[model samples]
Target: MAAPTAWIVAAAPLAAALSALAAAFVTGFDQRSAMPPDLAARFYGFFLDRYPLFAFAIPYGVARLLAVALAPGRSGALRRVIGAALGLGLLLGLSLHPTFGGMVLRAGFGTGSGAFLNGTPMAAAYAFGAAAAAGLFGSALGLGAALIGRPGTPRPGSRRRRAGRAILHALAGFLALWFAAALIGLAHDAGFGPWPRRPLDARDAAIAAGLLTAGALPHLLLVAARLRRATRAA
Candidate 1:
C-alpha cells in the first residue's frame, strides 16, 4: 500500500522531466518553421499544434495519476501537498498559453480603435486549458478528502467527517483558481503581442501524452487499491 504512494511520488520528477522534454520539442518545432516563409501566415501554428501535449497532457495526467496512487493511508500531509502543487501548477500552466495570452494582449494593446487582429486559436488552446483545469480540479478533491479523512485506526464509535465535503472544497478551489487565471491571462494579453507565440508541434503532442500516461496511470491504480481496501474493511 505504502509502496504505491512511494511509486507515485517517485514519478513526479519523472513527469516534470518529461513535461520539460515535451516543451522543448514544441519549441524546437516552432524554431524550425519560424523562417520557412511559406508557412508564415500560420504565425501561431507552432503553438497550436503542441500546446495540448505539453501544457495539458503531460502535467495533468502525471498529477492525477499521482493523486490516485497516493491515496491517503498514513502519510496524508505529503499527499495533500503533491495534490495541491499539481492543481495550482495546472491552473497556472493552462492560462499561460500563447493563444490565451495573445488574446489578453490584443484586448489591451491594439490601436486605440483596436487595430490588433489577434484572436484565440480556439481548438488547441482552450482544449488544453480545459483538460489541465479538469486534472487540477480532480486532484484538489481527492487530496482534500485525504486531509480531513479519518485515521484508519480510529477509536471505537467514531464518525468519519464527510469525505464528500472535503472533495467538494478541493474541487471548488481548483475551479476558482483556474477561472481566475484564465481571466487574468485574458487581461494580460489585452495589455501586452503577448509576443512570440510558442507554437506546439507534433513531437510535443506525442511526448506530452506519453508523459501524462506514464505519470498518471500508476497513481490511478493506487487510488483503486485504496478504495478496495476500504470496501474490504467495511
Candidate 2:
C-alpha cells in the first residue's frame, strides 16, 4: 500500500468510533441515569428504537468496503465467505432499522407488558448483532479489497506488505474493541462489577470513561505490538 492508501485504510475505524461517540451525545445518553431493571430494559429498547442506522451502520459498511478495496493484500477463497457474511449482515441491519419492522417491534414488544421479555434482553441481543454486523462488514470489505485490488508481495522493505499487515492488525484491534465493549455492557447488566450507576454525574462519567479505557487497553496494546512488528518487517 502506498502512504495515501495506508492512511485511508486507517481512517475506517477512526470514523466508526467517532460516529458512534457522536451518536451517543446526540441521543443525550452521555450521562444516563441509573434505573431499576424494568426501567433499564425499557430505556435500552427505546434507545435502540430511535437509533439512526443509516447515519452510522450504512456509512460504516461503505467506508470499510472502500478500505478493503483500496488496501493491498492477497485474496483467497476466504474472501468469498467474508463477502457472503457481509451481505447477510447488511441485510439484517437494514431489517433492524427503526423505520422498518424494528419500530413495530420496539413499540409493541419493547415496551409495556411485552417489554419484560423484549426489553433489556432484546437490547443486549441487538448490541451483539450490531457488533457482528460491523465486524463482518469490515472483514468482507478488507477481504474483497485484497482480492480485487493489487496483491501484496512479501519481500524485504515492501511497503505493500507492511500496509497489508497493518490493515490486518487494525482489523484485529477493531474486533477486540467491539468484543470488549460488548463484554463490559454484559457485565454491567449482570451486576458483575462496579459499573457506574446512572445519572452519570462528573464523577460517575469519569469513572465510566476510565473503565472503558481500561477495557480497551489490551486491544490497543495488541495493535501497537502488531504495528511494531510491521515496522520491524519493513
Candidate 3:
C-alpha cells in the first residue's frame, strides 16, 4: 500500500478509539447511592469489563483485524461478505438514534436509566422496534454509500473521483462504529435483574451509539482496500 493508503488504514482505528473515549467521557456518571449495592456492583463490573472491550477493543480492534485477514489479495467474495456485515452494523446503529436520543426506550435523552434494565418481553420488543425505525432513513444513505464505494470500481487519478471515494469510505467507517456499539447495550443488559434508577443523560447515549459505529469501520475499509488491490492486480 502507498503512504496515503496506509494513513487511511491507520485513521480508522484512531478515529474509533477517539470517539469511544469521547463518548465514555460524556457518559461518565457517579451514582453509587442511586441504586442497590449489588446492582451498582454489577453496573461497575460491566463498566470495567464489557464496556471497555465492546466500546474500544472488540468491535473496532477485533473487527478490523478480522477484515484485514479475511480480505487478502484479490478476494472479492470475502470483501463483499464484509461489506454486508458492515451494512448490517450500519442499520443496527441507525435504530439506536431514538433509543438514547429520547425517542425509543426512554422518553428523553437525559432521562432515567431504568428503562434499559426492564426484563419484560414487551419492553424489549417496543425498544427494538423503535430503535430500528429511528435508523431507517440513515440506513438508506449508508446502503447507497456502500454500493457507490464498491472497491476497485473507482479510478485512481481523478480528483473528483478520489474525493467521492473518500466520502464513501467515511460513511462505511461511520456505520461500522454504530454496529460495534450494540455491545454497549449488551453491557447494560448484563445481570438482567432490575434495580433503582437514575438519569442516564446524553453522555452515555452518544457513547453507546459511537462505540458501535467505530467497531465496524475497520472491517468495512479493509475489505474495500483488499478488493481495490485485487482489482489493480487483475
Which candidate leads in TM-score?
2
Q: What are the per-residue Cα lDDT tens digits for candidate 1 across 74-187?
A: 556655566556554543333343443233223222221222233545534543464354444345434444443422322233244545544554555455434433432332
Local distance difference test values of all predictions, in order: 0.42, 0.45, 0.43
- Residue-level lDDT tens digits of model 2 in 1-234: 454444455455436544554544445452255456664553344334333222234344454454454455655546634654555455444435543323322333234334335555766555555465345444544444444543334436579876786677657756764654444334334333222222223443333334444444555455335334444445
Over 91-128, each residue of candidate 3 has an lDDT whose tens digit, in order, gives 33442333222122222111223345455465454345
Q: After superposition, how far is residue 127 of candidate 2 from its true place, in Å?
A: 14
Candidate that scores best on lDDT:
2
Sort by TM-score, top down from the best: 2, 3, 1
Candidate 2, superposed: residue stretches over 4 Å from native: 1-182, 187-204
Name the TM-score of candidate 3: 0.32
Reference-based TM-score of each model: 0.31, 0.37, 0.32
Superposed model 1: Cα runs more than 4 Å off: 1-27, 31-58, 70-160, 176-234
Between prediction 1 and prediction 3, the one with superior TM-score is: 3
